[model samples]
Target: MTERQHTDQALIARIDPAALLERTRSWSAINSGTHNLHGLTHMAALLADAFAVLPGELSLVDGDAAESVGADGAITRLEHGRHLRLVVRPDAPVQMLFTGHMDTVYPVDHPFQTLAWRDANTLNGPGVADMKGGLSVLLEALRIIEAAGTPSLGYEVLINSDEETGSFSSARLIAEAACGKCAALTYEPALADGTLAGARGGTGNFSVVVRGRAAHAGRNPQDGRNAIVAASDVALRLFEARSPALAVNPARIDGGGPNNVVPDTAVLRVNFRPGDTGEIERARTLIGATTRAVAERHDVSVEVHGGFNRPPKPIDAGAARLFALVKDAGSAMSLDVAWRDTGGVCDGNNIAAAGVPVVDTMGVRGGAIHSTDEYLLVDSLAERAALSALTMSRIAEGALS
Candidate 1:
């Protein structure tokens, strides 16, 4: 082993459990939903303070304007809060990009508002495992690295507020920051067993609004072309577009009226994950054709919003080497690091698209994410911090290129 490896081993042993848990507790308490601008702004300020431990200029940059369709089919632009950008030694010989999201699937009105202990070592709450715990791991790992000494490898940390909603506003920022970096790590939560995500499918979320003539059910119903029925038809077509490689999910449908009225407006929200770039393009074309065909067939007007944003993160040679580095780091601590392809897309996908190799699920081990049952294994906080510290230190030492 090299002298740098010795230093890495020493630093990994310095992982702090108490501080990690405290940070997680602090972050998970806030409900930073994608649409909660106030909550996200507050969370960004808190994160800016916590990340101040590292040598970096932490600043909040305004996110891109996001669009939402109203019930009347009017598109409105909304802000995605602010994105936190941290730069440390950007001119250093080695460059890396680390990313995560501060937002959660839960909203302010969600009943799962606070963290509760499932057991002495298990903490449950929204965003606990999904990413708040991951951010804690990231912070501690960087602190460990900086404490060891100033690193030769400079890194950029982007904590965007809109990733839960497909990174509508921060995709450009993520890609631009990753341009010159050799490697990237996304702090999305890992499985309970500490496995990472290897290849990830590119995902696109779409909202299709259908409009038709509305009429009272008890009156001349024939004068109305039911939009709900048209929207349902579009939903079925999208679902049928799925294949063994392309996974399509008709997540939800909104804008239905009372039973006594022939509903003339309906919105269908759907998401699809494609295994590769070609598949993503195919999905787009198919969806467009299907939407037009369905609209014409049902005599309705259709409007579509959103498209594929993150390109697929394939486990090519570059990505495989990156995973090997992480797995080796894990093995040093008697931890067997493993990974598999996930259909779930993340900001890591965007980074990988920039030709940077990335291991996305480097966060704390947790499960039952995006739900009330979300929980984090408290021990993994210290364990994964050590693992990340080792990986980062090695990367800084020119072990990975």
Candidate 2:
């Protein structure tokens, strides 16, 4: 091994695999769903204790209230947990940002709660890969850096509690922290083959409430408007709006009544992912037109909620350089790292929107994320942490440029 590889190994040696896996297991034991306030609070407290081992000013910031339209069509604030922020060296020459989410998609009622050994090298659980293990990797990398002594660069860490729900509450915080930083890293779990996500499409989740007049199906049915039919119109229009690069997923429809009655209310949920800003604007226009058309035809009141929350994450020149740095760092340890464009959006989109270069997936290699079969590779705990440690150490010493 090269002399620098030796130094990286010495630093990575501090990342004990057993300790990392144990920490991951402990974290995975907690059900910190995006909507589970109690679970999030518990997980946040544990994170505070674990991250305290590093040198920084750690604090929790409450997530901004998110607004959602209820069945009665009333917009209300959705409660969420506080976000964790830690600033290690604000005055250092080089600046970087690191981010991860404490929330998972699985709710408290979800059956996939416990971690079990799928095999000798794989552990399966609700969030073992997407991404309690990622946070473990971030903490381990930072621990190595702190042990190596003072860093030459400044860095900020933001572990938010609302990333799984579109990061609406912590969007401002992420943008504020990422602004003016030279580079950013988000631990969002890499593919089992080690390929990180590259340029991403934008995602917009919309809820269309269709309200119409109800009447008895047996009497004067023509006098009443059907909300379910109206919602179906809107769904069809949304489906027709799909383009070659744009995807439209009609997720669910809520509010239906007995077959004898013409339903008065129906809610249609549609999710769209656009390839770029052009597609985003066009999508918004098409959605507005489609909803208006359907509501007018069915004589129903339509209220649309939600929009493109996460903009596309395009890999610009600066982001490419950041990717190159990670590639080089991985190469140093004989780990070939690569990336490909993805339609999935994450906090990396918001950070990249702030004009900061970001390599979003620096976490452990895993598969079947957001599913009951989600599994984390046992050895990736140390392997990914080592890659991150080398990358961070290089950035701190200004060797990345």
Off by over 4 Å in 1: 1-5, 216-219, 256-260
RMSD after Cα superposition, model 2: 1.5
TM-score for each predicted model, relative to the true structure: 0.94, 0.96
lDDT at residue 241 of model 1 (Cα atoms): 76
Lowest-scoring 10 consecutive residues by lDDT in candidate 1? 65-74
Q: Tens digits of per-residue lDDT for model 2 on 1-401?
A: 77887888788778888889999999999999999999999999999999999887999998677898776556789888999999988888888899999999999999888889988999999899999999999999888888887468788999999999999899999999997788899999999998999999889999899899889999889978999899999998889879876889888888877888998988888999988888888988988999899878889999999989999989899998889889998998788889999989999999988999999999999999999999999899999999998888888777655
- Give the range where candidate 2 is weakest over 10 consecutive residues by summed lDDT: 65-74
**Per-prediction backbone clash count:** 0, 0
The model with the greatest TM-score is 2
Compose the digit string of candidate 1's lDDT tens values, residues 269-378: 88888888988889989888998998899899998998888788889898888899999888888899999888888898888888999999999898999889999999
Error of 2 at 62 (Å): 0.5
